[model samples]
Target: MKKIRAALLGATGAVGQRYINMLDRHPFITLEVLMGGESAGKKYGQAVHWLFPDAIPERFAEAQVRTARPESAEGCDVVFSALPSEVASEIEQDFAKAGFTLVSEASSHRMDPDVPLMIPEINPGHLELLEAQKKARGWKGAIATTPNCTVTGLAIVMTPLLDNFAAEKAIVTTMQALSGAGYPGVPSLAITENVIPYIKNEEEKVAKEAKKILGAVKGGAIVPHELPIGISCNRVPVIDGHTETLYAEFPKAVKPDQVARVLERFSGLPQKLRLPTAPERPIIVRRENDRPQPRLDRMSGSVPGMSVVVGRVRNGIDERSLQLTLLSHNTIRGAAGTAILTAELMQKEGYIG
Candidate 1:
């Protein structure tokens, strides 16, 4: 098998390093370059100060770390972008226009009509827009983004119900992990034992991105649903997963067991393609009362290295809603893992050669 040559745009950052560990053993991917900003030209061993100790590969030591230049990643089959949002717009756009497939973890172009905000299990069909993106921009490649960490879990649980019971209104309050803010994020003083009530742009992301992911595809464009999505976001002291408290109004009644079975068996596009990084079961529901705790379920055996774990499901009567708590590895499932899964799906669908 010919391995796909790949490059990592922010190879030294937290999520970028996860991309390194994942692609290192990926049977279909070959890491060709490790790019960074100020850290460019540093040894990979030194560039990444903290890692799994065993996850960093010896082969990466010789890989040159350079600031992203169009010509640097010119020949790669795909580029996994972990660049900070501040600089991602220009860098990612240039790569896409230069004919390199760009799978990103940034919100820069997520709302762009041409760019697909995808969660493979819920909306794999959204990949169809990649063609339109490429042609509309006269580029050789395209871009795709994962929903915000909080949005990933919300959409996973809501998808089945929308199809079955028809979700009408979604009210979500998220306790997000500090890591969601990125490296050297949130000061220890501010979060050691605190729960700050603000995460700029997060609430809006959950509201809008959720609708887009659940929206129907029509005439080669995404038509977002008019469902009411009310979201509240907060930054917590946890290191890994972001947990959400949700109250979803359903158009019809649903049994608790019915909802449980749906989540247990839920598998969509990524599952069918068997994408290398795709989680076998997109939504894993825990029967135990306190099962999907951050430290415990964030990186469970089922989706090792993938982000997300959901639990605490219950049905409501008068409210006509279902309530649950959701947890996902903010950087993994919510960012890098999803990007890798997207790349693998693109590879399987022949979007990448």
Candidate 2:
């Protein structure tokens, strides 16, 4: 693996900090440039309201944050964006036009017919759209995106069920961590002792993004899966993992034990290639009745926080439906980790150098 110069956008935000934390000492990818808005011209360590208790890496701690623009990323091989949706749209596209391949953690481009909403483990093939994206958009570079944090764990769990048992519908309810709302998230007064049952546009993003992730690529475009997905999202007091309960309907009766086996055995292209950020098992199945709890299981995996932990597998309303609880670290498996993994796959497949 050649050393890959990397640039980060929104470098002072919550997910952006995760990118820095995870990339320190990375074997190949180096955090070459940090880009941001208000933080621009300031040192990264001083600008960021660091979330992780571990100290910021010394080198990045002293690195100057640059203005969010393509020129600031002058020599990077790939860009990792943690920018918010409202402003990320234009800024990211500007980077794409300037010829920098990017893997974004924003909602703006995920649904673009040409932009792949990626989950490396679920749809590595969708990256094939990049070439088409360049041609259609008339840009020197292209962009790939990771789905919303809530959708990340849900989509990964749905893949095996849909493939192995022909699951046709999914009903999901998510108890999302506070970190998911971004830095300086939900005021303590509003969320400390309460569960906010609504997160604007979250349920919609989950359903739509999950389908695209579980979809197939054909004729240079993704043919979104027609699976019916119903989701309800809530912001919980928990600070990191997003926990989701999934009830899936299948054409044929499938036993809980059988479902567990398939999920436990699930692996994808990244695992096959042993990508640095890919977990040994993309999904970890727990047999204990009260397992997959956020604090204990959210980070469970060969690569900590990269696997989806699933438990409470059981028969649903009927034998043809199955229910289970799943959890993943919102900042790791659901944000920076997946984006970094996608970049690894892109580099390995000759999309980025």
Candidate 3:
């Protein structure tokens, strides 16, 4: 595989910084251009409110942040947009219209009819939509998006359940981390020692994005899975990882051991292709009753923070139902890591150079 040059759209923000951290020594992709809004003219290190404990890699720290525009990304093989949703809508479109292929972590285009809302493991074939996306949108480039942070782990867990045990409906309750809100997120007065019961739009985004991601690509578009989903989202005091408790109904009786076996063995295209960012095991099932805690299990994987960890697999009220708890790193698996995996998949599948 040839080395690819990549540009980032929101280089000074939280998710953008995660891209820098993860891409610092990427096998093929190189972060050549850094773009930002108010921080556009300053060097990345100087402008960012750098969140991670580790220092920002020196190269990216010194890289000057460019204004978010298509020309700012000239010569780059791909553009990764980590911009906020409201602003990402316009700027990302401008880049696509200008011929820059984009892999974004923004919510603006996730539900678009032609655009792919991807979880590479769950729907690699969805990338096929990019071709029609380019044609229908009348642009040389196309956008491929990732699911909402809250949806990533839940959807990953649901995939095997639905396929193996024929799970018919899901009831989910999430205790999300503060980092999911981005830097300086959830004010001290608002979130300290508090569990905010609501995060506007999170529940809906989770259900819709999960369905689309788990959907099958048909007729040059995706036919979303029609699984019934009931979700209750809440913001917790944790700093990373979103934890969700899921209760699912299946068509027939299924055993906890069977569900554990299926989930623990799940893997997809990225794994088969041996993509650099692909986790050795996308799902890790724990047996202990008090397992999959956010602090301990969020980063549990060969590829750290990339796997969804499940525990407490058991029966629900009836023999035809199942229950489990899941945890995933909100900023990593949920944001930057998945986007990078999508980029790697794109490169492998010849969607990008």
Higher-scoring candidate on TM-score, 1 or 2: 2
C-alpha RMSD values across all candidates: 1.6, 0.8, 0.8
With a 3 Å backbone cut-off (N, CA, C), the pairs that clash in candidate 3 are none
**Candidate 1 residue runs with Cα over 4 Å from true position:** 53-55, 305-307, 317-319
lDDT of 2 by residue, 125-161 (tens): 8999999999999999999999899988998999899
**TM-score for each of the candidates:** 0.95, 0.99, 0.99
After superposing candidate 2, which stretches have Cα over 4 Å from the reference? none
* lDDT, model 3, position 15: 91
Model 2's alpha-carbon lDDT is 0.93
lDDT, model 3: 0.93
Locate the minimum summed-lDDT window of 10 residues in model 3: 213-222
Off by over 4 Å in 3: none
lDDT for each residue of candidate 3 in 1-353, tens digit (9 for 90 to 100): 89999999988888998899899999999999999999989988899998889998998888899999899999999999999998999999999999889999999999998999988998988999999999988998999998899999998999999888888999999999999998888998999888999999998899998899888888888888999999999999999999999999988999999889999999999999999999999999999999999999988888899999999999999899998999999889999999999999999999998
